[model samples]
Target chain A: MDQILTNALGELLTPMTAAYALAAIGLAMHFGFTGLLNFGQAAYMLVGAYAFAMSTLAGLGLIPAILISFAASIVLSFILGIPTLRLRSDYLAIVTIAAAEIMRFIVSTTGLNDVTGGPQGLSGFARDFYAINPFPAGEYGFWAWTMDEKGLWVRVVAWSLVIIAALFVAKMIRSPWGRVIKGIREDEDAVRSLGKNVYSYKMQSLIIGGMLGTLAGIVFVLPRAVQPGNFGTGLTFFIWTILLLGGAATVLGPIIGSMIFWVLLSLTDGLLSAGVDSGVITFITQNQIGGIRFMLVGLGLMLLVIFRPQGIFGNKKELYFNG
Target chain B: MANEIAKGKAEPGCAKVDPILVADNVVRQFGGLTAVDVKHVEIPRGQITALIGPNGAGKTTFFNLLTGFDKPNSGNWVFNGKELAGVPSFKVARLGMVRTFQLTKALSLLTVMENMRLGYQNQKGENPLAAMFRSVWKKQEQVITETANELLVRFKLDAKKDDFAASLSGGQRKLLEMARALMTKPTMIMLDEPMAGVNPALTQSLLDHIKDLKKEGMTVLFVEHDMHMVRHISDWVIVMAEGKIVAEGPPKEVMKNPAVIDAYLGAHHDSDLGSKKKAGK
Candidate 1:
């Protein structure tokens, strides 16, 4: 029981939690701020991860590889936005999910095995990134919370990026450009009548959000190998859960939401596993734990939708999911 | 046509004064139905010209075409002598023409002050890159806030500056919409049913604001159904029926025309004329 508590608490500082928080913040910008239903956000992460891996594998430096990945995300945003932004919100949702699936298939195809490593994925790209880490080589933690040098470095970088990105987004939403995008979310015709190029604004919003997702992708792969299967539709769903668990529009919602999500997930997994091992319950096997945990999260989400549709921090009046 | 007889013009096309807006042979159709089919119409510069029609007469549709909110099926139009065919609505607004919708389009979630601030054009803070830095547009934002506050005061919505626009009353929304439109400092203002849903007590104030647009050297074109308000404020009136301009003249002259009365009251034109005459006097 003590180990379970420690493990759940430690999960909060992991790079995966920070990555999900970053991606959720980007998703908030798309759905909450701009009212865009971009269901292919996982595709952006795939592109970013693959682009970074391929560039670094081809002997590019860290800065060039990161820049290349960001550029690829922008290109992907334009490709997705041009055909769908002019249509209704449902079309974007449909196209994005399809595009993300297509991207996953393309990266895992046998033909791209040399570059993407097919299902096995690419590794050894993070060595260059970790080489510049300022943290000294040693275990660092207080009591049950602990991490090695590499783990500490990745967490430090990932969480720092998340904080900076959150601050940037919080400020952006308060500016005139932010107001215009919010107005576009409300009614594009009203914004257009005010002499704002609505299409351009939507495209800009798509690119900015996509780039944030790309950065999240980089952070996600820093502590692990670049696995193509990781950027599946499930990833997008997880980000969505995190976004809604907090407030979709508020800055701190995604961060706090991500932490809570991981903590709950880990807590459930630890409790169920412990219950099975100790023979306290025998109705379900160990194999069913993962599914049951997800079921609990889904139930929580359903309850949130019924009672607090605006999430924890969101204002009820600002809740406009229909764009 | 009887419309030509009232105006005493062989051809009812261009205004006698310099025109700010000119549309020729503009037509819009919805499936088999023709929505708007204006042969020719010119709105005079620096004057409040009222576009009046019975229900389903395409006055709002015409306003939509002229303001670039909707495209015409055929023909072209010009604003300030510049051809505006195929121009987008925002571009048209940037070119000094702006419009308000029949159902008020106040961003309900935004505060009244934020809605007003959105009307100002060409703010450096509106640029995505520049917006991240407050220093880039802080002073301009301050200036815009001052201007927005002043407009709110003038429109008697100053007390509700921090309140969400959704909380405003119907008449207050109309006032806010009009006030927001003025934030653009438009050269030409087109209002669609500015009096609709407004209380009778606020109608006179709305009319005065329309007149004040002309006084400020801004050309105003508005669609209105209230004949009394039309005659009281409009310098020129154009009447449409069945997607065609049937009459054009000063309000009193247009009201006296048989073509205008027939289109509005159908076969009971005589009784409507008597009431109109009494109201006009």
Candidate 2:
């Protein structure tokens, strides 16, 4: 039991948590601040991951590969934003979800096997990144928290990016530009009447949020291989859960929210598997634990929304904005 | 009163003596229905002009077209000597013309001060890159804030500047919307039903604000249902019915026009509804 508890707490240092938190911040920019309903954040992550992996595989240096990923993020944002930005917000939600699925299928198809590695996915692209790992080649920390130099590097880089992103977002939200986006969120016509180019502001927000999502995608795959299955619609929804669990509009909400979410998920998975392995649980097999933990999360989400729609860190004053 | 306002005898589609806005053959249709079909209309410069019509008279639709909030099927309008037919609403506003909505859009989630600040344009801090550097826009933001504070006090919304717009009363929202529109310091202001849904206590203050705009030499064109408010504030009145201008003149003359009276009341307006069968035309 003590070991299980330590294992669950250990998830706090995983790069995956930082990745989700970064993407959640991006979603907050889109939905919370700008009132843009982009439901295809996973598509952005996929694009970023693919761009980085493919570019790196083609002998491009790490800087150029990352730049290519950023460029891809902008292209994807425009592809999604142009047609739907003029319409009501709901159209964006529909287009994004569909576009994300389409991208996943494209990357997963056997036709793109040589380029995207098809279902097997690309690997060894992080060689340059790991080669530059400043940590000495040795085990770091103790117990469940212990990891090698590469693991330490990945976590360090990922968390640093997440912290920088959260701070950047918090600062931007208080600026004059933030005012325009927030006004657009409430009423686009009102902002337009004030001589603001609402469409341009919306597009800018889409690009910035997409960039954040792209960075998150890059971080998400740094410690592991980039898989086509990982960027499914479920990924987008999971990131959304993290955002709402933290606070949709607040800066620190996504960071803390992601931490709590991963810890809870890990804790539940640990406890359930322990129960099954020790023969204390009779009904469910080990295979069912993964699905059961998500069910618990769903119930927790429902309860959170019902009891506190403003979220844990969400301001009560901004409650009506959510409604 | 009508002679000074119009070049000749006041009538439907009459020309203003000193026109600020001129539209020729402006028409808009929604599927089978024609919403607005103005042949020629000129809004007088620096005066309070009221656009009055009953429900479904296309007054709001016309306002939408003039403000570039909606597209017209045909016809072109010029504001301040620039062709503004295909211009977007934001560009139209930047050209010194601004409008308010019939339904108040007070940006409820934002503080009243933030809403007011949004009304100002061309802030360097509004640029994303420039926003990262405080030295570029901090002083300007402070100036904008002070100006917003003064506007809030003038509108009697100083006490509520820190409060979210959602917390305001309906009448206060209306005031906030108007005050926010003024952040642009527009030369021409179009108000769509500014008095609608407002409390009677605030109505007088709203009226004084409109009158104050005229005193500052700003052009005001407003759509309204209240005849008393129109008569009390407007210098020129243009009446519409069934998507066509029916009368144009001073308030007293326009109010007395049989066409205007018939548009507001029925054609057989003299007949009483209580004794409708006996008084049938």
DockQ by candidate, in order: 0.55, 0.73
Candidate 2, chain A: TM-score against the reference = 0.97
C-alpha RMSD of each candidate structure in angstroms = 4.5, 2.4
**How is the predicted docking of candidate 1 categorized under the CAPRI scheme?**
medium
Worst 10 residues of 1 chain A by lDDT: A314-323
Q: Native contacts recovered by candidate 2, as a share?
A: 0.82
State the lDDT of candidate 2 residue by residue for A1-323, as single tens digits. Answer: 99888888898889999999999999999998999999999998998899999998999999999999999999999999999999999999999999999999999999999999999999999999999999999999888789999999999999999999988888888999999999999999999999999999999999999999999999999888989999999999999999999888888888888989999999999999999999999899999999999999899999999989888999977776532
- On residues B1-281, what C-alpha lDDT tens digit does candidate 1 reach at each position? 32322334523464545778889999999999999999998887887888998999999998898888889999899999789988989999999999999998988888899999999999899999999999999999999999999999988999999988888888999999989989999999999999999999998888888888888899888999888889899888899988989888877778888878888887454565555544531
- Quote the lDDT for B272 in model 1: 58
* Prediction 1 TM-score vs. true: 0.94
lDDT of 2 by residue, B121-187 (tens): 7899999888777889999999899889988999999999999999898899999998998998899
Reference-based TM-score of each model: 0.94, 0.97
- Candidate 1, after superposition: displacement of residue A272 in Å? 1.8
Once fitted onto the true fold, the runs of candidate 2 whose alpha carbons sit more than 4 angstroms away are A320-323, B269-281
DockQ value of candidate 1: 0.55
